[model samples]
Target: AMDDREVLLTRQEVTVAEHGDWAEVELYEAYQNQTWERQEVVYYFSLPESAVITGLWLGDSAERSERFAYRVSPRGAAQAVYRHEVRRRVDPALLEQIGPRQYRLRIFPVEPQRRDWDQDTNRMVVEDGPSLHMWLTYRVLIKIEEGGDVWPLPQLAEKRNVYWDDTSDRLVNGEPMAADEETWLPPAVPATSFVEPGIHRVDFPGGESVIARPASDEDLPAWPEDLHLAVVLDRSRSMAGRQAEVRAALAQLRRIADSDTVVDVYLTASEYHGEEPTLVELSWLDLGSITYAGGQNAAGLLAQFEALHAGQEYAAIFVFTDGSGYELGDGGFDVSVPGAPVWMVHLGDDLPLGYDDATLEAIQASGGGVAGDVREALTRLAVALEGEAYDVVDGYVWDVLPTEAADARDALDGDFAPFAARWLILAEMQRHRGEINELETLDYLHDVAVEYGVVTPYSSMIVLVNERQEKLLDELEARGDRFEREYERVGETEGQNALTVTGVPEPEEWLLLALAAVALALLYLYPRLSARGTLFTKVSHH
Candidate 1:
């Protein structure tokens, strides 16, 4: 039963000071018994009526470093109203209570020098050795009603609990302190009036007023006339099975095109027989022209747009691609349009698109557009055409569709859940970039990809490429060391042979000697041959 005993409090004190619309209460207590194992101490404060607990400040003490946990809760509450395990500081907003009349504070202390049981005491003591002293001080701030008098200061309840002994006890009696023994109090400042919930003005006695209002929705810009719409279609081999969906989406878009809206269609692929991405009417779009082949050429499509929309002020471009063949060609697509926005419609499902998500996002972001599925792009387009404001939720702007627009977009047969899921993954990764290491980021990407059944190069291709690049650099370094060693060996050999003659023949000297011998032989043979020829001819004639 030694562990079933509670540490007796030797001394206790409570002090309260009244400020305008606020009261600061300070509690001081001392404990003689202590334990090496962590122990919990609980304190309760019964607050006045119409009191709003605003802030709490924990006083510094010798046991501050040993304090492992602190929690505050309403009277008789099952769960802690405010709990902090790693931080001692508590905020006012966290402790805001409108109707609670009582609050409890709990602290856990761990002293390394004390033992759990004492043999001489014949009962549970903090430690078996000399008396160990422990103390705690706490300050609580409460806000009261305006024009209300601060009387009946917060009273400290005698009931307390010890975790090691699992028993409740009362504070031991101590001599009452005189009023002069209280600590010095700071002067109270004037409290400002709390602003009303809605838009209003609070006028003070000094002719000054403060305006408070909720944020207003921004007005949508006017829909411009002469709006030129450009549609870029990807006719790559990867889009073979998805051509029907692409065509259906285009058909829906054609329906939205009005007289003021001039729609131009362009086809992009690696190889085109003739001048491709040529201008065609909406009626001319058919399955025959959707011959999927070659690679996707985003740059070529952008060039077509530049040529077609020259000098056009109000225009919008929609790019439809299955995200394949994006890596086949140069990604240097100049997507900068002064007054035009480019929306990317990512097609297909769960396939590894050639273009990385970052590249596509950058392209869309350059034009202040979004990259999503076909339906999302169409829905946003409809909202823009109708001159409706984008919905602002949770600090992010969203393009919400009207009922009619939603119905129209639903008619198109394509799913964008994969792209949406991928975007969520990317957003999370970007948000936690500074907090997580590279390995952690990769692990998160892998886990998310498996959960959503999506393909992401972050966990696969990108990591592989990085590893390959590292291996290549290592090989190049090894080769460089070998070359350096060979050069040094050759230099050392030449240095050793510096004084010795190489005995190598000089080509100039040998050539001059051969020339001299040939000249002598030719001079002697020419004279003898001329004399003999003349004598032989005269004897033959006789």
Candidate 2:
């Protein structure tokens, strides 16, 4: 395949090892630079919604590589270190989440190809370009849908040189299962039953096991009989053909509504009906009339929605959009909704291309949660309004087995194990961000991310070249973690000033060094010239 902008995705191979309820997915990618200069290859990808990143490795050759699972640091510090190391022309790879199920992989200095001689032609020949290979592995809980158990792999936009290695021969270390061997599956747990709050374990292949526990059982507040709903619809250019889907999703609200339910519809790119909440019947709310045009202003539309209903309380607020052209306004949504929950209903089949995970997390933290589809949105809304618990799992989940698994290893030996813990922890990390007590929340998330060895917004996956680089990362984290403690004691400004990390010299420092060298040279030559006497010039002044 032809390269794109001198960056060629030479090869991509994915291996899926399914273990009943969950699967381990390993993706290998090779990139080559087609030009005569070093390059930074940036690739964007998306994975299953329930996947947890567990490992990342990068190297010039496949035989040896550096692992990113060695250390866990705050995202900002990790980014700063990555920039610093990249400037030094050292090996450092960064994998960060850009949106829900969306990730950005950055590998530096794809070295240029070496020139060679053509003996027969009596001309210079160009050899193949240098390549960088990366291996990424993550654990995903199998999604149970109407079709069957599904494990979604990373979907890359570039389809060239890609291979899916899920054949039976390669499913388990290139060994196929015997025909007489029976497959194991986890014990069936009814979706409606109330699971106890504690650590639960399940066994998997290779003596590995998974564990999970419920987080909470807090029921939704009772719905208001006189419901006043405000729907913020996105009218961006990307929503042109998706208007029908939005209308159909909104029409489902009528199913759970009482006769008193009143709705006010506001378009993100259009003028509102009026200052007063224009009560439209659920059946008569004509979403078809709202034209999809211009860019989406989610923050401005929400502000207007709240402004128009000043001194009034709403039952619930629904934001309908595919999250394209979505911008995060200044600070988090600090508005007081008077006990009303904000439901961010995603309205597309694809992963949101524009909005990052932060935007969705912030909205969910504002009292409501994110719904994957129209049916999920309607179901969650009904549950929230009616104060009835439906399908929900509350608790912390982990990829590894519980501490108690060691003592009961023999007893717990089985084929199917509850491997949903890793996904649970990943989901909790998303919600744990942007909490009221920011410091404590970050501390908790950082610990969990490190303990589980997963990449998250609070924590990032950073691959270093050697031991010295590891020391540098450790030092940087120490400085940042210290500053976090100081931040609570003194204030934001003083705390930032107190934080300092030593690494490769900055540009300003290098400039200062150059000036000092010139000054020293002048000082060294001045004495010699003065001693020679011929350099001195005498002048007569009036």
Each prediction's TM-score versus the true structure: 0.31, 0.64
Clash pairs detected, candidate 2: 202-417, 202-418, 203-417, 214-394, 214-395, 215-394, 215-395, 397-421, 398-421
Error of 1 at 509 (Å): 50
- Model 1: per-residue lDDT, tens digit, 1-542? 14422443434444454442233444444443343333334443444322323223332233545422222221111011112210211111112111113333443332222322223332322232222223322222232337632233444432233322112121212334322212111212223443222222222222322222233334233335566677877676777778777877787766666546667777665554343555565556665756766665555555555666557544567877764443354444543333455666666432222232333323333332334466556545544455323322111233322333332322221122232233344444434534323445545554654443433333211111124333432343233121111101100012111112344424654675686588567544544554332111111100
Write down the lDDT that model 2 would get.
0.52
**Quick one: best TM-score, which candidate?**
2
Error of 1 at 89 (Å): 43
On a 0 to 100 scale, what is the lDDT of residue 40 in model 2? 69
Report the number of backbone clashes for model 2: 9
lDDT by candidate, in order shown: 0.38, 0.52
| Residue 11 in candidate 1, Cα distance off native in Å | 52
What value of lDDT does candidate 1 attain over all alpha carbons? 0.38
lDDT by residue for model 2 over 98-156, one digit each (tens)?
Answer: 44466666666677654443334433355666577788888765555454445556655
